[model samples]
Structures are given as structure tokens and as C-alpha cells.
Target: MKNLPLGMNTLAKLIKQNCVYVDKTQMAWQLICQPGAFFLSRPRRFGKSLFVDTLKEIFEGNKPLFKGLYIHDKWDWTQSYPVIKIDFSDGTLQTRESLDRRIYEILFDNATRLNVTLSKGRDIPGTFGELIRFSAEKYGTRAVVLVDEYDKPILDNIENRDTAKIMREGVKNLYSVLKGQDAYLQFIFMTGVTKFSKVSLFSGVNQLTDITIDAQFGTLCGYTHHDLQTHFSKHLDGIEQEEIKQWYNGYYWLGETTVYNPYDILLFINKRAQFRNYWFETGNPSFLIKLFQKNRYFLPDLESPVVTEEILDSFDIEKINPLTLLFQSGYLTVAHTFTRRRRMMFLLKVPNLEVRIALNDHFINGYTDLVNEKIGIQDNLYTCLENGDIDGMLKVIQRLFKSIPWRNFTNNDLADFEGYYASVIYAFFCSLDAEVIPEDIDNHGQVDMTVKLGDQIYVMEIKVVDGTNADKLNCNPALKQIQDKGYADKYRGIDGVTVHEVGLVFSKASRNLIVF
Candidate 1:
């Protein structure tokens, strides 16, 4: 296999080093050939930086890089524009002062590159405006502005509203110059992980056409299936094609075909075709877990979050929604879209196994009990489920609840509701990477959960008592529901499968488990 572009983002270096270049020049050509400014939002490590660099190279008249590429003759190499590249992901920007200094330095560097002397009396916004005009005048060509990770400064301080707001204003001031200096700008493109609509950066430069959800540019940053087979065919020796596709592919943007996480694919091939959680290991995403916990989001509801276009686009930080955060942050993706009463609806789901499995671990850590007790509970839980020890599994659940801090249960009557117990049990099953149909509705009614083991299928019925009244809370009723309702009937005659019915009841006051 050719030298994989490992941790490579610069377009010039990637080309000069003779790395396998997936020709995305066609998409680059389409973007620049059009008019006005544009913004693209993709997940981190999705080649946003490389795409920005590619645009910079195209405008800088790097014709040799596109020699055998798709847009070799299609691009106009005679006219090269001075490019002003701004990257906010270089250093951490916690305070507004740091943000201001960083912008000043970036403008200074750009001026030095264009061989243009900037005035000492101007602020950042004024300096940026001067750079655009001066660079255009010096090079005799309109300057092309390319910004990578434009929202990093704001995103870094997102948890703190005060700090984030300060950083937001600083970045906004810098971007505001773009609107008035349009005459000196050829084309402007900005890429970031998040789109902050409330920030003045977007409001000031309102002409920026957001192509984030636009289906036309879905394959702009990431590799398509065709891209893999055509470009990286040499590295596909022992890899199972379908398995690879299942693990790394299926990131949809409402396009005809799905987009694969190029980072995962590259690492998978580089590591001798090993299937691993390459993308998930890079970022833990504690923010998402915190958001879900704060919002009291139903874990099972994440399976298929139905949302509208407005929900997908406008992500207001003040009133943050789990679905919006999940979708934008790459945990969830547009699985399918349909029209209902003339309004479009989108169904979002976890992209692949790497995300589903990894997110489960993170969710368990944040949602349920974590660490010390979690390790033992989960270990026994998995072992018991595999061995078809329903009693052992129940003990694990009892242990899980007991391990939680007393303060957690002070106000929250978690044991009072069947949904609460079912959700916790569901989370545990999912965390162990088991197949569980949570809230499985059968002919007998709604079963709490149905878990599939090697040769055993377990149908679980969970009941909760309001008080210590055994007369009102009978385990026989719960047991009858599982059998009379025929919850496990479907799996009874399946080949090489054994069906087991588990009826469980828990008391709200005592928090004791009773299995029938």
C-alpha cells in the first residue's frame, strides 16, 4: 500500500510526499466555481482541515498537485489568488483576551505571507479588513479566505456561558470584516464542528450560504464508498468489505450514498485491517453525556430520534436539546427522511457499531453508576446473562441500585416507575454489547426488555410497587403477564434457541427486588 496520509492535513505536503490522494478536487472545483461565501460543519477528524488546505492550494495556483486529478484541466491555474487561511484550532482559547491576541497574530502572519505591511493603529477587525484589501491589491487578485475550526474558540468555552460569550464576541469581530470587504474577496469558506447561530459571527456575515445539510456537498469532506474502492484498493487485502462498511460507513447527510469516517478507515487499513473503535477512542464526548443527564433524556429514545429541519439546523446553546447536540456532534446521523403533511421529517440513528458501542459506555458512565461498583456489576451482569443465570442477573441489578450514592435516591423515586428500572436494565445490556429489545411489545402486552444471548432469548417483565403493600403488588400478577401474554412465545420454536421468562418486581419504599 502507498504511504497512508496518517495525521496529515496539509494539501501541499500530502501531494509532495506521494501519499494516496483521494481526488476531492471535483468538490473543491464546484465550491470555488460558485459565487459568495460558504460554511460547512462536519465532525472533528473528518478532513475539514485538509479540505480547507486543498482550497488554499487551488487558489494559490498549485497546478502540479492537480496534474492527474479530476479537476486538472477543469481548474483555471493561470489566475492564482492570494489566500488568507485562518485556523482557530491551533491553541486553546479560554478567555476573550486570548482570543483577541490569537486573531491579531493570525492576521499578522497572513500579512507577512502576502508581503503586505499592515498599519499599527488598527484593531483586529480593522486589521483583517486591511489584510483583505492589501492582499488583493498586492497580488492583483481578490483574496480567498479559508477558515478551519472557526468555532473552536467559542466551543472551547461552551460549558461556561460567560467565557463562551466573550470568546464569541472576539471571533465575531474578526469575521464581521468579511461582509464589507466582499469586493476584495474572491471566495470565502469556513469549516467547523459546530454552527453557532446566536454568535455575531454568523449574524454579521449573514450572506454565508450554509451547505452543512445540503445534499450536494455531502461527500465534500469525507470519503464515499466509491472513493475507498477506487483509491485505497491496495490496502483492502484481508479486510472483509461488508464488515468494514458496517463498522466505518453509514454517516448520512441525506445524500444518495453514505459517507465513511476516513479516520477510521485509514487506521483500520494501517493496522493490518483490524476492526477497532478508532474514531470513538479519539474523543470521549463527556459533554454529550452531561447534556443527556441534565435533560433527563430517555436512553432508549435515542435509538431513533425523529426530528425536523429546524431541529437539525438551529442548535441554540441556551436551550440545548439532546437530539440536536447528538446529530451535530456526529453521535447521531440522518438515517432516513420522509415527508408528512408537506413537512419534512428526519430520523436520526447512531452511525455505526463503533459509535453505538462506545456511546453506550459513555452513557452508562454518566447516566448510571460509574467506576468501582460499575466494573463488578457489569462484569457479573455479562457473565450471568451469558450463562443464562437470570437469578445472577437480578442480583447484579440489585447491586447496581445499591451501589448508587444515597443522595441520588433522596429525591428521585427511581424504583417507583417500571420505565426507570427497565431503562437501567436496558443500559446495562447495551453497555455489555448485548442485543436487547427494550420495551418489547408482544401479544401479551409490553414486556420490559427482551435480551438475546448465544442460544437463549430472555423476555423480562418488570413491575414496581408504590408502597410496601404486598396485596397490591403481587409477583404472581407479573409472572402471569409474561406467560399469559405469551411474551416468550415467539422465540420458543426457533432453531437452536431456548426461551426463558423472567418476572421481576421491586418495592419503591424498601428498594428490594423480588423475582418470580
Candidate 2:
């Protein structure tokens, strides 16, 4: 078996080292068949950089690297175009000056490689336009431009809105030059994590085609099921295939095929097939979590969010939508789609078990004060649910809520809002790997929360009341509401599974569970 291409992004190195390569040259060929600007957006570590490098090797006419590849026979080896490359995956640039320096270094390196001298005393845009024109003039053919991680500079400083905006304009100024060099450029393809409106980042080059959601290229970067069964079959011997798919294979791009992140697959095999949060552990999303909490977003909404096409397509630094950020950052993915009022709508969900567990784990931390104790609580909760121990589960939940820091409610009205408690509970259930549904609908009305665990199911309702009346209940109002509304009736007859109706009440004065 060929060696796995762990952390390898360059196409030439992978081929030369005899690493397992899923053939993407067919997609590359299709992309270059026409000469125009193209843009693709994908979450980080999803093989965007590798695809960009593949395009570089192809455009440079390195036919020796294409041995046994699909594009080798189809592409013309006699003609090679000048290629200018820009990659921002190396280091973080915090300010405009640093970003400018990095841009110059990238342009200069490309000019040196292409043997084109940039005009001295020229600004970035002027120098870029000059390099494109000169490189095409010298090579006697139009040039191909490939940019990897095109939005990284702006994203690096996203915490500081002013700096982020400045970095945005700086990169925008550089990309603006591409518009005037249309006659000199043969093809332009840029890859990034997020998609900004053309007016925000690519107004000058507004003609660029965005293929991020194009069905034809959906499987271009990630590993498909066929790839796992074929290219890396040797490495997957004795491993539970369904388990692997459950952990890592659910990302879709409006295509028939769902794919596994190459990073996760490579790391999974390298670590001897131990199922872990391989991809999620690579980056910290503290900013995203903070943003979600700042917005007071209901954690259960992430179970399945319905969004319009406009919500997913437009991203700007000035107003960052938490949903868009989550989707673009790979924490959420498209699960289903439908037409509502003649408009295309998407049903977004956590792609797989890896994301569902790991993301909610983070949300648990963000929503509560018990950081170190979360794992213990989640473990106990899991056992309680699996064994159908409602009393044990209630004790664990009360313990979980009792640990919340008072500061979480001091400056905020969280104590008065039932959603605050419900969201926290929802996040805990999600972290336990329970099949949780928020606002679950029934024939009568909507259930506040529904959880399916092993052979047990729970239909729950939450209510907030003042501490003065906390002791006056003959029946837990939450449970009474569930029984009154017939929320559990829908799941009562399922074979081999027991349906449970649970009601929980919180006291505003104590800011904790009062009745369970």
C-alpha cells in the first residue's frame, strides 16, 4: 500500500512519494477548459490548498507529475502558461502594514519565479497589474492566477473589527487589479473559507464565477465513499466502515455524494483507526462560541436551522451572522433543502457525530461555568438515559445547573428567561450524544424538547416561576403541560422503546431548578 499523504498539500510531492491519491485531475481539467475567473469556498482543512496546488502544477505544465492521472492525456503539454500564486495559509498578519509586506513578498516571489521584473516605486495594484501584463507578454500566452486562503488575512484580525476592515480593504485593493488584466489572464481561481459579496471584496472582479456550491465539483476536494473503499482500502482493513462514515462522512455541497474531510481520514488512519475529534481539535473556535453567546442564540436551534439562500451567500465583516460563521467554519453543514414560497431554503445541521459531539461540548463550556466537571456530568447523564433512570438524570441535571456562575445572570436577564435554562439543558443533552430535538412538533402543539436515547425517549417542557410560588404545585407544571398537551402520545407506541414525559421548572429568585 502507498503511504498516506499526511499533512501533504502539494500534488507533486504526493505523486513523487507514492502516496494514496484520489483522482481529482478530471475536475481540474473541467475547470480549466474555459479561461475565466473562478472562486471556490470551503471550510478550512478540507483540501482547498491542495486543490489550488494541483491547479498550479497543471498550469505550469509539469506533465511528469501527472503520470497515471486523468488530465495527463487530455491536457496539452506543448503549451504552458505563466502561473502567479498567492497563499495566505502560512502565518497571521495582524495589521495593514504587515499585510502589505506579505502581499509584496508574494508578488515578488511570483515575479522572480516567472522571470518578470516588477516596476519599482509602483503601488501593490500597479505592480500586480504590471506583473500580469509583463508575464503574459514574456511567456507569449495569457497567465493563470491561483490564490489559496484568499480571506485569511481578514479573518486573522476578525476580533478587531477595525483591523479586519482594514485588512479587507487591503486585499480588496490587490484583487481589484485582476479586473484590468482580463486580456492578459487566461484563468483565475481563488479558494477561501468564507464567501464575501462581490461588492465587498471582489467588486472590481465581479465577473468571477463562484463554484462553491456547484454540484459538479462537490466531491473535488474531500474523500468520497468510493475513495475510501478503493484508494485507501488497505489502510481501512478491519475497521468498522459504517462507524467511520458516522464519525466523519456527512459534508455535502448540494450534490448526490457526501464526503469525509481528507484531514480527518488521513489522521484517523495514521492513528490506527481510533475514532476521535481529529479535525475539530486542529483549530479553536472560541471567537465563534463567544459570538453565539453574545447573541444569546438558543443552543438547540443548531439541531436543525432553516435558512434562506441569501443568508448563506452573503458574508461581511461589519455584520457577521453567527449562523453564516458556523456554516462557513465547518461546524454546520447542509442536510436538506426545500422550496418555501417559491424561494430556495436550506435545512442546516451538524454534519456528523464528530461535529455534533465536539461542537456541543464547546457550547456546554460557553453556556456554563463547570468546565472541568462537564465530562463527568455528561457521562453520568448518558448512563442515566441509557438505563431509563429519570430520577438519576434529574439529579445530574440539577447538579449541572447548580454549578452555573452567578455572573452569567448578573448583568443579563437570563434568570428571567426560560430559554436560558432550556438552551443550557439542550446543550447538555447534545453533548451526551443523545438524539435531541428542540421545539419538536406534534399533532397538538410543539414540544419544548425531545430526546431519544437507547430504548428510551423523553418529551420535556420547561417553565419559569417566581420562588414565592415554587412550593405551591400539586404537580410539576412542566410535566403537567407535557401530559395536558399530549406531547408524548406521538412516541408511545414505538416498539421496544419507552416514552417518558418530563417537566422541569426553574425559580427566577434562585436562578436554578426548583421542580423536576
Model 1, span 177-203: residue lDDT tens = 888998898899998987777454587
Can you list the residue pairs that collide in candidate 2? 479-503
Q: Judged by lDDT against the true structure, how good is candidate 1?
A: 0.81
Residue 36 in model 1: lDDT: 74
Root-mean-square deviation of candidate 1? 2.7
In model 1, the worst 10-residue window by lDDT is 406-415
Cα lDDT computed for each candidate against the true fold: 0.81, 0.90
> Which residue pairs in candidate 1 have backbone atoms (N, alpha carbon, C) closer than 3 angstroms, thus clashing?
444-485
The residue-by-residue lDDT of candidate 2 on 1-516, one tens digit each, is 999999999998998899998989999999998898899989999999889999999888899998888998999988899999999999999988999999999999999999999888889999999989999999999999999999999988888889999999999989999988899999999999999887799898848998887789988889999999999998998899999999999998787899999999999999999899999999798889888777888788888899997788788888899999888888888887899999989899899999988888888888886789998998999999999999999999889888888887767777788888888898888877889989999889998999999999999999998874666977798988888899999898889999888899998888788898
TM-score of every model?
Answer: 0.91, 0.98
